[model samples]
Target: MASYYLWRSKFGGLSVPEAKRLKELETENGRLKKLLAEQVLENEVIKEALRKKW
Candidate 1:
């Protein structure tokens, strides 16, 4: 797909090594983002529970 290529191009230029590194970094970045989101949601739920105390 044209859109897929367009999005993939944003990672790196013509070098294969660069492209591989870019993919690795993107994968790590996504994993870290997911972890952060989970922690944020957990914090919110705990906060809500605390707010309900008499």
Candidate 2:
């Protein structure tokens, strides 16, 4: 995609280690986001179930 190319160009000057670190951080960020989303969904389900009980 054009946006991807544009982003790559912006980071083209990064050293190999910098690029590797960036990738690691991105992966961790994605994992944390997924975990947060799952927790939110579970909370919503629990709330709904409690509402029905009362």
Measured against the true structure, the TM-scores of the candidates, in listed sequence, are 0.75, 0.82
Could you tell me the lDDT of residue 39 within candidate 1?
100
**lDDT of model number 1:** 0.86
In candidate 1, which residue ranges exceed 4 Å CA deviation? Answer: 1-8
Clashing pairs in 1: none
Model 1: lDDT of residue 45: 93
Q: What TM-score does candidate 2 get on C-alpha atoms? A: 0.82
Each model's lDDT comes to: 0.86, 0.94
The C-alpha RMSD of each candidate to the native structure, in angstroms, is 2.5, 2.4
- For residues 2-53, write the lDDT of model 2, one tens digit per residue: 9989978967889989988998999999999999999999999999999999
Query: Please, what are the lDDT tens digits per residue for candidate 1 over residues 1-54?
Result: 998889767854547787888789889999999999999999999999999973
Show the lowest summed lDDT stretch of 10 residues, model 2.
4-13
- Candidate 2 achieves a global lDDT of 0.94
